[model samples]
Target chain A: MEQSFLAYLRGRTRNLPSVAVGIGDDAAVLNFPGTPEFPSTPESPATPDSADTPCLQQVACTDQIIDGVDFRSDSQPLASIGYKSIAINLSDIAAMGATPTAALVTLTLPSLNATEIAGEVYEGILEACAEFNVAVAGGDLSTYDGPLAISVTLLGTVTAPWLRTGAKEGDAIFVSGSLGGSLSGRHLRPIPRIELANRLRQHVNVNAAIDVSDGFSLDLDRMLASSRVGAELNIEQIPISDAAHAMSKDSNRSPLEHAWSDGEDFELIFTVDESDAAALEELSADDLSVNVTRVGSVVGRTGLWKRITGSKLERVFPQGYVHGETDE
Target chain B: MEQSFLAYLRGRTRNLPSVAVGIGDDAAVLNFPGTPEFPSTPESPATPDSADTPCLQQVACTDQIIDGVDFRSDSQPLASIGYKSIAINLSDIAAMGATPTAALVTLTLPSLNATEIAGEVYEGILEACAEFNVAVAGGDLSTYDGPLAISVTLLGTVTAPWLRTGAKEGDAIFVSGSLGGSLSGRHLRPIPRIELANRLRQHVNVNAAIDVSDGFSLDLDRMLASSRVGAELNIEQIPISDAAHAMSKDSNRSPLEHAWSDGEDFELIFTVDESDAAALEELSADDLSVNVTRVGSVVGRTGLWKRITGSKLERVFPQGYVHGETDE
Candidate 1:
């Protein structure tokens, strides 16, 4: 449903001038007619009264998660569900290399214990907002005879947004944090890579980026497909989390496949010019909130390929991984 | 659920200056750091590139509608459900006297026929956006084992926004369009009154305003409560719609009762100074897109009351009308 609907919407609204970035990416960036209030970067500190910069754009995206499918509403803490809802949307803004400002949350709740759930959920929402300094600008609450659904729309600002279509052949690809451990109860506590994205936005020439919400290989494929490019991943270089290794002990898939295909890691996959990728190594561990690993490079070849250090590159099989209801 | 949650949210986010208008209104008006893109009113007629006006505020509100509760998805046309979701949010913006700019739509789909429903819903969303000249700025899609829900967050620009807390003790109250017929199938096709709101923004000095999503008497009571005042409605002068009259034939309520107590009329209930109220009558019918009626007046008393043209006032009895899953 997500794929078919997104494709149809993209085909319908392809040439809209108001949309700087459209339906296929992490978030839609809109260029309203106005001068920027202040520079988005820290290169020059500007006050709110300052309007010396170029046009500013508004970035907006929403992600809706359900109870039975995304989480066990009956088993999980309501606060965790609320926190995940807002964090995933914040990740979408980070994927766009934008600063999150505010959010509008809509909760469609079941009729039983609605007030209790709403209050606890609001507590979680406030917790997430306080961490990001984002205002809970607006929201709606609805009750129905269904499982709880939390849909949050995060709004932000950007001047030079890193879009999915900007990556060219030969750009270096990097991903933040270890992956494939999310299903082991980490999905409810996502850490949006906002600070890393801000660092890249201020200091590097990022070509394209996406949050690994669906999976590493699948989301990387989406970004590559949108850019009309491909990538070559070094299988030996892909970082695996401890949870993945533990899950592999019981699961049919190996740790490597889990590292490549597990969803809701909330890590970031980004690309940069080779020159900037080289410069990225100079930053100490303290310079970043999360560890970033160089795993691949963009290529002109039209599909994903993987190879060990000494092996010939081979087409990466699909693995039949399902892209769930996860989105920006 | 709606009242208690709204009260809780209001108490939690009371004194944030960045939010020019907060939780207890049609929408949250945010004063972001920037000058105006263009004059929100027709009086100045400035272009977008010009920043010669005051600071611009963004009005954001979301309304989520679900099947079985807000509508019968299995019975109602899917397109009407989509249209109502967007239209209700648009009405929220109109209540703020803001011009619609863009919208973020989130669709939570039931597992079966998700793609087909999404397509039909998008058709309705596009149809509504075209009529209002609003850009479909962003959206997200998800599927779950629950009833379908459509939540739309409307973002708009406002220069001089009318709030729900500014009505003077003697202000004259007015409502747009005939009321009461909403549940007679009019609830599914709401009229946002955007043009009427724009007219009021451009010309009238609206003291306080609210959209009558609930019953007319109840919404009026809310605006008065926000204003710390009361209202005296002339029962005979209330504009009862033809649908209300038809519904009275079988319903256990009278037409007047229906006009005063039924919900989802999507009418605008507003207040103006007594002087400006007289001046409003000078405008011709073509100047406004909807019919305006002087149904009541703000009073110093503390609760809603009703009266005949020449009779004494009496307190209005609560009809046990549930507030339901509504709000900006």
Candidate 2:
């Protein structure tokens, strides 16, 4: 079974130059074209040539998906499981504003129908890689008696990579796409904002960035804590998805609460200087692919808050999906 | 729990310059100092200055451990489980003859006292990282209803990485340390032959290399298949550990059979040009840290064989632990 899987991977990853040693070795050896310094922003939005342009540095992140916890194998297609596992890692790469290059997948499968399920899962993984233009260099496969688990470690290259701790007090906070209600099938098929992030970095000075995976409030809190800053959200200005609004119909929780609490939204939350906010808005309006919403602003205070209609501010608690604590 | 763990990681990796975004971010940003070309072999055995030397490429590998399968949490220490998980990944790096740089760990835990057990597991992981000088850049943690699992993805840099397909027909095969009886307590604490691999590469031209994770016969078969070569083993020259002999007393299998079939030795099996075999042997004898044995020679025939003292050759089956099929 491992041999067949390895053969499948070898066929998939065979002619990639960056992958010096692929499926047959104990590890994959990768070679990146060297550069003297970080490349400046291109004047036009043309695809960068790997042969001519040099990669300065690499960024890396890893994410995992577990059956029943992350998704239900009985309900979701194996391809979606594979796609989501890769997408979430790519989201982290997007947060860093890096161009994803390669990924290594590790799978732990149960004894039941291992090979066929593994083949389906790998097809899904390859689909995501093909969509994102990432090479599936190598991976490890093992059997477990428990539910299926997939872990993806992705590597990318970035010139001026965005950091979560780069935000300033005078910056305006913004988010790409609407937020919340991931339970309504959005969590299983997230489109990682990789291109949008790179475009944003090229167009405006993104001071800090993060992916809203553990809910908007908690992810924003993370960015603030890392940058040693605070944020004040305008409750009316926050964009809520239709899914969140629909989910809020049967409960006391409003769409706004759903926006703040529902996690697994693989959207980009970034900060830009107050002076560049207008330019960012104009760029967002011109770009039809993504809807950028200015939800809040970085505040001088040292804690998160929400401003009500009457200019009254209330402290916002860091409530979101915490692992081992949150049910979802 | 995730926040505390991230804080703990921050404290540990704060000083590493390569780790641009250590923790509290979606991903870790790594900055590798650029070089004009691959650095030539060092004149002496002194450690290469990272700032001065140019790393040509990076190597990556991933491995996973699941409770009750890879280890029994009830019988094994949490630290040992953590140690073995990291050790196996490092062994892959060692097989590439690369220096381990960073690691990303993903863990899924059951509902039983996860935080404390995770902390102990992390302590074990950090201990191994400190010993190997590999940084725990970042990781993901989640909860599950099934058994606990840990997957580690490791990154390393090497100028000239040894590949499994580099063996020549006339190359002499050598293995570091004794083989067999890994189930007799050695599997949990098998040492990665990182330093030994580097030393072997520096002193001699290693044609091909692999770590003995799936027994000598099976792993050697993997290398032979990749290299399009075969091997003839001098059964008398094969090194068997005392534990293998002790285990053989309880079974019909001979110590030699255990040496060939028992997996998870985590030792290195490599091929070098016949000219450098004597030099490698001399170097190994001088360095008491590792034991090097001349086990076999690469052959033209496309099959594995063991030569008996009476000039009779017996075919060796490539049998060992295989994931998904093997119980252990």
Candidate 3:
């Protein structure tokens, strides 16, 4: 299988710049315009004073979506599979505040129409690349026993990459777009938020950031864990997605609970200094159609709590979505 | 399953630097160290005009190993499965003549022991990273109904990467180590020729190169195809692995036949100018225990043929395993 694919791939891939080295070598050789490490020696540069420069600081993350766990294979088309595969990686890049550059895809398919599946998947990848202006680059394909699965590794560049840390005690929390209710089909096709991220990178000095893929409570805990701090949320101010509101109306759960725990909302949950909030709000209005709302502050000790009534917030679900616990 | 795994991932991943924009944007914000379109400034030093000025280049490739196709689920151990997944990607990088820098992994699995599977797989990946000095940076994971599939994307850099198109008419064709009989188990544990690749990049201006993962005839055809030319193999000079010889002896097929058609050898096949033959041969002798032999030569013609009985070398199989071809 791999043999024939190699023959086909050698024929198909073309138009890359004159690579110093190409396929078939022990390793590939490439030629590129070199960048100075620092500003002083436009030639030699500052020699990269810090080990943490974005150039050296590698951004890597992996997310998993499963059949019956993340999607239904019987219903999801091959194009959706391909799009979703790359989309999820793009979302991770967005979460990191990085500009995606190259991507590598790995696929496992059943014996049925593997070539057609691959072609369709690549088509989906090409579409996403066009949308993001990034290259699909390269990837791996294999046959699997049971389900069709894809793993994509996307490369991105970060100039002043935002992190989950750096939030201060007085920081105000902001979220891009509404939260919750993604479980209703939107989970399958949620935008990765790449544009919103690019816009944020240009206009905001966000201290800490994370995309709300899991529930707000869980994702918030992640940010706080990185920041070595916690958040105090005003339940009344939480911007619940309309779908969450509708779901809450049918069930006994509050719209707040759905907002707190429903997964697959690819919105950005971020923290900014109090001084930057108003300007950020204005920028959000101008650049993002999505709502950027402030629902809480970074204060108190390192613990999560919600203030439904007033400043006196209460602890919500501590230890959001413990591994295997929910499955249990 | 994805949600739970992601929740765990958010916990395991540390907040690191180079985060031009950390985990919450549309796309990642990264600073690629150099200008894209122009020659390097005096300070940056444009590559010297020498024929051998090895330039920095990006080498990319991807592969997929599926259940039923790449491996039998219960047959291989989890640790081996994990190692093979990453190893396969690294092998592709090595084949590109590039030093792997990072990799992204995507996994789709049945709900069974997803994390355990991930842990084992990552353990394999981390081990390979430690061995190769590359990072297991990022990727996507999803579950499905079909089978356990692992896809990895390896990113690599090359000094003077080799190319298939660089093969000149009359350049000698050479392959590292022996070929054929990989199915005798070497296919499962094939070593990625990364070290050999690095060394070759340093010592030789390899004209054309490829790993013999596919059958020699087919893989050789691919190299010749990329060069837009034909090849004539000195069949008598082809190296046959003992395993391949043994297999042939058992099967009543000639060792020559297995050497020509067996897949998954993972050996490097390359071409270089005959003028540099002495230097390359000496270097291979000093650095690698394996033998590098001259097996064939590039020709002006555009078809692939073997050199048998004086001037007539008949056409062998065009290439090795093609994508989507049935395993049987």
Chain B TM-score against the true chain B, each candidate: 0.90, 0.82, 0.81
RMSD of 2: 11.6
Q: Candidate 2 chain A vs. true chain A: TM-score?
A: 0.81
Measured over all alpha carbons after superposition, the RMSD of each candidate to the real structure, in angstroms, is 5.4, 11.6, 10.3
Candidate number achieving the greatest DockQ relative to the actual structure: 1
In terms of lDDT, which candidate is strongest?
A: 1
Kindly report which residue stretches of model 2 are placed more than 4 angstroms away from their true locations once superposed: A1-55, A285-288, A308-312, A326-328, B1-55, B308-314, B326-328
Error of 2 at A290 (Å): 0.9
Question: Candidate 2 on B1-328: residue-level lDDT in tens?
Answer: 2223224434433233233323332112243333323222121112346445434456777788888877899999999999888999999889878777677778787766767677678778877877887666556777778888999988876665677878899899999889899899999988999889767766888888888987888888888877899999887888999999999999889999999989999888899999998787777444636889998899988779888668777888887876555432
lDDT tens digits, residue span A147-230, model 2? 888889988766556778788998999998898788898888898998897678667888888898889988888788878899
User: Where does candidate 1 stray beyond 4 Å?
Assistant: A14-17, A35-53, A307-312, A318-321, A324-328, B14-17, B35-53, B307-312, B317-320, B324-328
By TM-score, how accurate is candidate 3?
0.81
Q: What is the lDDT of residue A207 in candidate 2?
A: 86
Between the candidate structures 1 and 2, which one is better when assessed by DockQ? Answer: 1
Ten residues in sequence with the least summed lDDT for candidate 1 chain A: A37-46
Model 1 TM-score, all chains together? 0.90
| lDDT (10s digit) by residue, model 1, range B193-266 | 89999887656889889998878888888888888999887778999999999999999888888988898999
What TM-score would each prediction reach against the true structure? 0.90, 0.82, 0.81
**Two-chain DockQ for each candidate model:** 0.37, 0.16, 0.21
Backbone N/Cα/C clashes per model: 0, 0, 86
